[model samples]
Target: MNTRMNSTASEAAHQFIVIEGPIGVGKTSLARRLCASLSAQGVLEEGAQNPFLERFYRNQRAAALPTQLYFLLQRAQQLAALQQQDLFAPLRVADYLLEKDRLFAQVTLDQAEYRLYEQVCAKLDIHPPKPDLVVYLQAPVDVLLERIAKRGVDYEQRIERAYLERLNEAYARFFHEFEAAPLLIVNAASIDPINNHADYEELLAAIRRMKRGRLYYNPLRSRGI
Candidate 1:
């Protein structure tokens, strides 16, 4: 945690916040910043630690199963560890949700591979903590592509546009029916919360104010011209 990023704790309404979105939508970056601002513990996934990730980017069909499985196991372990920690600790923020693992498996794996993945899931019997608030980010495919390019991860740059399209659709459907927690959907394409101080502060204010129900954070609509 960079000392420069730290601030007096915002006293967020939610003790546990999960930041979710399609790849390149800046979930991880926002999660880290939120952790700093809220003085929260971060339960971030180690996506780079997955050995099969680069290969999966290059050849989705060939490496999808192993890649998904590795992520599943890794994320499950991280959440399980979180579960074991003291329940009354400070606010906790995470970059990914356990349910998204199955979402990815559905999008990436073939029919035959999916059956095996399901069996593996059944065997693991994961039980992730329910988040008090979920902040879902949304952006256009073009924005996603541009952001991904700007990040300049060698393997990530190999990602296909078609795959990203499917992922965006999958995320849309998942969040549409999501009812496990209070949902706050932000139009990430309209706000650069990561680099812009005003934008981050405004969004952080919205986060601390949320209690229940689904809310959309569209600066354009909120501004009312």
Candidate 2:
């Protein structure tokens, strides 16, 4: 909506852009906004339809496996649709990455369950196209907690701060080692790119500037720090 992110958007029309982060980090809002901004298809995770999700949240230890397995099947079905597309299909914006499912599995599932999950995933071969760019959003635990509370999702109310902290740390480590795509690591502790035009455009400019490798989106840098 705001100047189309770039005028020559067609050059990158085939890009698969993904937004990644822990829960409450604004992945869905940004992904949807960016999809509309770029005139691309919106691909969101339908974890809410998993049926096992609410129960898992209510009693994670008891329902983790079923929840994780349901998600695995759901992802396979979704990605399989993408895989059926032409390789040159127009740009798409997804709130999640294909590989990051394992990240969740690692954090949520234990040794035996994780192994089984991996084995099942290996058989699915849900090899969707990789994103041309990944925007990894990060925020402090307090900010994340505040946003979570504000969203008023009853299931998410059961999430502990400790688990969110651990998930945040896991995300940091994953992105630190990630190299499959150009990474844009945004410190979103102080800005709302989805609701504020300036913040949104700042990230758009950063996307315009990034061509390869990794970059950091630090608001402090803009403050002359």
C-alpha RMSD values across all candidates: 4.5, 3.9
User: RMSD, model 1, all Cα superposed?
Assistant: 4.5
Highest lDDT scorer: 1
Residue 45 in model 2: lDDT: 93
lDDT of each: 0.90, 0.84
Best model per TM-score: 1
Worst 10-residue stretch by lDDT in candidate 1? 1-10
Q: Where does model 2 exceed 4 Å of error?
A: 1-14, 221-225
lDDT by residue (60-164, candidate 1, tens digit) is: 899999999999999878888988886466679999999999999999999999999999999999988889999999998999999999999889999888999
Give the Cα-based TM-score of candidate 1 against the true structure: 0.92
Candidate 2: tens digits of C-alpha lDDT, residues 2-86 = 3346657643533788899999999998888888887878889986788988998888888989998887788778888887875
- Per-prediction TM-score to the true structure, in the order listed: 0.92, 0.91
Error of 2 at 117 (Å): 0.8
